[model samples]
Target: MTDAPVLPSHAYVPGHTARHTEGAFDPIRASVREGMSSKELARTEAFRAGLAFRASGHFWEAHEVLEPVWMACPPNSEPRAFVQAIIQLANAQLKLRMGKPRAATRLCQIALAHLDEVRGEVVLGCDVAALRVEVLALSTSSELQYNA
Candidate 1:
């Protein structure tokens, strides 16, 4: 078979739409994903920043902070799935904050599905089981009081 073209590191990630192409091959994103694969997920500043934003009730910012790391991971990889789960969790919380319970519930379910692929394992320092418990509560509740 002919060899695949040697695209630059800046080439678009597979499955990303054109709108998601900005900085698609960031070096920092690659570094963070590499670190996470070696148990350094919690040590990465970007991951920690996303966690901080999530804990402080800034879900949209948390999603933005974590998205690059997720994007950096190879398709269908565990680290990618974990980061995607966390991003979905962040969006679920944002939906709740916006008073859209149905959308929040759907997002929470999607996040749980991603987390299940990891078999309740820790992701970026988050205890997946504990997070699942909280997310399940959020899914069922009509109101949320996050970190307030």
Candidate 2:
């Protein structure tokens, strides 16, 4: 069978990441403000928290926090798949964080399917496409083979 892809460790070399963190946080904070009501805000806050966890390399925490939101999204819509994709993607991320890139790559394929099916621009502030490109870079990298 064909092998899954892996990313190089140098993927984050574009620039200093922390400088861009504030811009990333803006939409999340906006989402919290634009929520329909307190309940909505609460839910959005949970998602924002999950994003923070994901950014911090705590993929399991991201998964635990995001899975419910993904699962709770209305059954037949882009947002549902988006969240579900995030959950699945987070699982793969957790695998990567734990140094199991092959398993992570497998999970990423599942996550990619859902993410690809999503419509319009990102429903939330999360940059799934950029994340996809990044993950794809890692998943397809030769460096991950033996490490896997």
Candidate 3:
């Protein structure tokens, strides 16, 4: 339902850790689980690992790893938003490296949208203001410079 295409709950999303169960686990619940520390599965470690990968500039690698988390996130949940933002961020970075500035800018915008719902500056890059600035600059530059 989001503007972003909903990728099929693939039988095997490359970087996922859990089985793709439909309507089973919720992202907000999972995020709370990670925070509470009393849940059966400690997801904080897993999330931290993914963040580390993203920070290290391994966008594609981050995509591969964080996807399951995104898929697992239920609608209207922080986990869903967080994973969505991370995935969008990684995809944008990948597109940038591929020289597709338009695609990159759009993806960055998607990330910003997700960031708007819920975020931590230390965790999500100090909010979406910076991302908005970057994406707008790229989009404007691309639009003005390339009209072919």
Candidate 4:
């Protein structure tokens, strides 16, 4: 079998670094909120796994667990964005563990924005607005605590 094509890394760009590509969050939100996609986002085993991992401070594992759910989402669905935001939040926590608070903060900011798309709606068994506030407070804090 032929090898898959290699994608370029974003490391070469300064100040343009992001966990996800720019402008990719909006469509996902619109799709979910508007019911543009048929895929229903239930709190499945994978979702539970991600939550468990995040709660246990296994941030990277949480990201891994939630990714498939995000991928299974129909393109531009709110569920997709919500999962992606959770993944981003996990990533931010991981970055914080790695002593990169700035990166973590930035990722949290992106996550908060994504969360804003469906603030009042309960998706993935979470109060999206409350989570947004928590993340926002974390991002804005002078120092973030681990497993916070």
- The lDDT, on a scale of 0 to 1, for candidate 1 is 0.65
Measured against the true structure, the TM-scores of the candidates, in listed sequence, are: 0.68, 0.64, 0.54, 0.66
Local accuracy by lDDT, each model: 0.65, 0.59, 0.55, 0.63
Better of 1 and 4 by lDDT: 1
Model 4 misplacement above 4 A: 1-41, 144-148
Evaluate model 3: give its lDDT: 0.55
Number of the top-ranking candidate, with TM-score as the measure: 1
For candidate 3, lDDT tens digit of each residue in 51-101? 555666656655665665555556676556766877788787667666666
TM-score-based ranking: 1, 4, 2, 3
RMSD of each: 10.8, 11.5, 10.3, 10.1
Error of 3 at 142 (Å): 9.8
lDDT of 2 by residue, 26-83 (tens): 4333333321432363357557666666666656556555655665556666776777
Per-residue error for 144 in candidate 3, Å, reads 11
How far out, in Å, is residue 50 in model 4? 0.2
lDDT of 4 at 148: 39
Lowest lDDT 10-residue stretch of candidate 4:
1-10
